[model samples]
Target: MGGNLQAEPGGIASFSISVRNTGNTVAQHKLTCASGHGWPVELGPSQSSTIDFEPLDILEFLPMQVRLRIPPVTNGSPPAGEVDMITCTVTSSNDPTFSHSEYANVTVSELKVFSTELFDLQGNPVGPEASALPITVETGETVNVSMSITNIGNIEIPLSVKLQSANTDWGMYLVYDGVIEYDRVTFNLLPGHSTTVQVTAIIPLSTFDGSQNAFSLTTRLDEVGTNQFITNGTNFLVGKLLGLSLESSGEKVQATVGAWSQYSLWLNNTGNGALNLNWSTAEPPPGWQFGIDSAPKSIDKLVSSEVSFGVIAPNLAAVGDIEQSIRVRVIGTYYNDSVEVFIDLELTVVPTLHFGLELAPETSVHDLPRETQGQIVVIINNLGNSPGGGNLSAIIVDGEGVEDPEWSLQYEHSFDELQPGEEISVIISVTPTADAGSGLRTVEITILGQADEGVIVTTSEVLSLGVTAESSTTAFDLSSIVSTEVFFSIVVLIPIILFVVVRRMRSSAKIYDDEGESLVAPGVHTSQENISERRAAALMEDVEKEDDVISGDISQFEIQAALVQSIGDLPPPGPAPLPTGLPPAGLPPVVLPPAVMPPAAAFSSSPATTAQDITVNIDDNAAQGGVIGSEQSSSEPMPEAGQQNVAIAGMPPVPPTGLPPGWSLEQWRHYGAEWLQRHSGK
Candidate 1:
């Protein structure tokens, strides 16, 4: 068996193990050891050792050894008997195997830490219970408070303090009194570093307080973790009261024109506040005017208490030194008063005039006929600022500047003083010879000195004296005359010649027949009736034919005859007899039925019709067939039979009244020519 050891009850146990190798071939051997108590055990190779066992927990112990291969020892001792049975092995080359095994024990402890510090401005330490300061103030007082904090801990501490007031009615309060909101800064503090903060508080008179008011301040540290601190200040007592007053300076007094006199007043603030005021004025005298100036007047805001503005007039007897009074009242919070002021003024009366003049009957005669009487009117006027009264006289002068004895007529009247704007009148009549030529005459008026000497004497400008001749035949003067013999001679001779020539032409063309019956050319008789119808055709064919030529010759003869006679003698002598017989040779016959013939023609044929027949038969066929007379044939075409019939059809039927047998062609031609000339011209 292998080496074994046992311990007796209540006794210690020891064991030894040995091994050797002496071969030249360098042999090796191993040794092992174990404990029955379960305590850690060790083994050795090629060495002898003894082991002792201690009972770990009151249990039996034994030692055992086993053999195992081992390398030779280098000269050092092996591990002790307390071996590490539960070994921590590392496979990495970076770790070493345990030569001996042991374990270490560890213990942990926690300590309290702080990040920020607290202190007062005077370097006084501020405890966690200290928060803010309290102070007392008056109505207008201001307060300032300053504070500082330090990093009391091993590490830097960040801190902030908030200040508040218990009473909001206090005018104003501040922390860091002079520091603006935007200028307050947050800072990082190093260990042992301290920062100072200022806070201010204010109380106003409006603050109502009999007791102290309290406010709180909090200081926080290391805002991240649960490290914080808080503090509060004691109550501050505040007490104050305010008072104010207002006054007014009366307005500047002024006046102007109105329906009647008027005045105005203004209440100006002259003290620290606004003011209300009352005002009034005195009545002015009659006819005197006054009014208030529209704009309000002001006074220095620091001086006068109240003022009055208005216009006034004193008693009439005091006009020399008239005075106006203005009343004013000051209505202010703490003051009330009234005052009257006098304004000096003077009354000035302006003079005026309204005067005019009126003349009695307003009319006068300048010049009259030799045996007629002429009259003159003189009106005196007091048209001035004063009355006028005086004696008046009148005188007349001829155009030659000689005073007429008859014009020496004088009219004097006693008159009362004419009031301003009054009038007076005076009259004077005179007789003068009507032989006065057409020229201006003068009427002098004089007023003897009575009311106003300067305006007394006066005279009118020249007056016209119209003189007319008498109605006697001797005064009618003829400017031109001619011998009655010459006048009558012309009057009788010219008419007779015209009459004789006209009668001769007519008698030469008078119709006479075998039976003495007159036959007027229908063409000549109806010419007037046919004028309008014939004019258009005639103008187209024979504008310059013999009928027109004869008309032109006749007009020339008339002009020559007019030159021989005066403009007064050109009307025809009398109405010509209507021709009743035929027209001269080469003219168309005019038929006369018994019903159209006169009673005289009923007994005998008219010479005009008989002659017209003879002339018509000679040229009727030729004329009816478009044969104009040899003289006009070259320039005019004869009318066709149809056109001639149309022309005849347009003629007016003859009236029942007919001409006598004595009528002639010349008369018919004259009447026809006159009618044709008038119609053509039209």
Candidate 2:
């Protein structure tokens, strides 16, 4: 009989058996085998060989062995059983009637096992027991650990793979066949087959440097009523990677000239450790100023910081925007590694223009004469931050609140291209007419400046001027004493006063005799010494006649001087010296009889009279008779009957032939007597 046999699945099961010839007679037989489980059965070592048995031999026993192979589990394989039988048959090759058979029992057994290992991405082994090895990684970095799983058992099984991390900050994942699974996966594995599953670990940026993390990968049966089988794990350490990020609050900045501008900046530390940051600038525009609030600051890992800076433009800066750059550096305090970043900045400037006027204290108020000129000096200033130019002018007004036509105003300064805080001096000239009286006056000066964008700015100032007189001292002014009309009338009245005084003194004079008896004649003037009483009446009539010669050329003083010279030459009138007393007193005593008067018949009939014609002979005693005449001398010549000759001494000569045409003959004969008459009248 075959002994009972047992075998594992997918392995060999063997048994030994003997077969005798049951048929009588020496017949040839074939030896064959059959299995209950439908397993492959071998009759001998050679599958095609047959065993011969002696036909009915007396007590002969032939030994034969059968081999059975356990079929691997498959979709078409029969169900496994606790026990199975294998039968061996001996049959006659020549006679089919004589055959014999024998059987053996077989049993099936299943075995399951698996192994695991860890490798790097390059397929190199990590360590003897991959769980004890440590891996280095930076923050925010992803690393893969290759895990190899092999099934060493005699059966195919489904498995569940899982990845786990020791630290919660690390992210774990499992990848198979290019598909990622979060920390766990399920798949099937056949016996004696190998596969690779990727275990990935991700480090967070917030993780600190030098931090440690442990990663575990485990595999187990996926079937029901099975426990986990294999486990693999690894360790990771956080490394230092220095990083920096710099950002500005705004990209553009606006500013004015000579003014300050401000902006904000933010610095972020992206490294796994702390860092020291330093900030600086490149070359800027000339005369520009910079101000920073915080510099060279320290920042922790994953932390951000904010700072502010200021910039001031120059006073003479241009009116447009400019570009500049700034740099920030991260000094690695952990690993001595550095990083740098540069940022571009923009600047803008604006223009402003303002003006002012400054007046000197002395020029603000002044005293001026009407004829003299006055001047005022002032300072013009630019008070803003731009370069500009404009116009300048002046206006004047008097105390009566009206523009004074007599007052003139002028400014000799022209303003152009003035810089900020620049100053210029201006002179204002003031002039007044002669008729501008003493009063107060005002002068207003104005300055205009052109600002940016065609805007105008103006400033003005006013000054006072006091008018005064030309002379300073008090004195008599002859030039102003009288007007021209009054002076000419005083010169014309001085000549008429002298002529009336001389005429009254000549009319009160008289002629006297030696005994105080006035020389007298009957009805005749006594002042005539050279003419008889008979010619005095004719001289008085001639002196009264109107003549042209005496009115025009002759003066009264010349006529009076001639009369005085002619009268002084005559002797004063007196009785002739008594003829010798007793003129023929003896002869008169002898015969004193009255002498007889000559009768009127004895005179001839002629009107002409002379000294000789009127003479009568009188004896020495003729005074007793009332007759007075002298004896005519014999040597005296006689005059014609109608003519007479008269002569006078010390008189103006006349025409010798006759009287003047306007004069009568009677007046010519007595021309010498007119001087005597006028002298006696005065």
Q: Which number leads on lDDT? A: 2
Off by over 4 Å in 2: 1-8, 23-64, 71-119, 123-140, 146-158, 162-169, 175-197, 204-214, 222-228, 233-682
Put down candidate 2 lDDT per residue, 1-682, tens digits, no spaces: 6555878667778877665554455555567777886778775666632454445463456666677888764431323444778777777667668667776788776556567888753345666444464665678887777888887666677888877777876677788989999878888887667898988877898987789987777889887788857777767788765667778865665554444566877777765567766667666667777766766467887687876767766654556666564443334455467777656666666555656677756563344665567767777777556767766777776544567676776776567777878888777777766655344556667666666674323233233444332432337422222222343454444455555555555555554534213322322212233334335434453454556244467654444434443443444457432212121211121112123222232122212222222211222332232222111121332222223222222221122222233333222222312323332333
Per-model TM-score, in order, reads 0.19, 0.26
- Give the range of the ten consecutive residues with the poorest summed lDDT in model 1: 609-618
**Per-residue lDDT value at 514 in model 2:** 42
lDDT of 2 at 201: 78
Model 2: per-residue Cα lDDT at residue 96: 63
Give each model's whole-structure lDDT: 0.37, 0.57
In model 2, pairs of residues that clash are: 25-55
Writing each residue's lDDT as its tens digit, candidate 1 over 5-76 gives: 332222223333323222233322222343333333333222332232222222322333422222111111
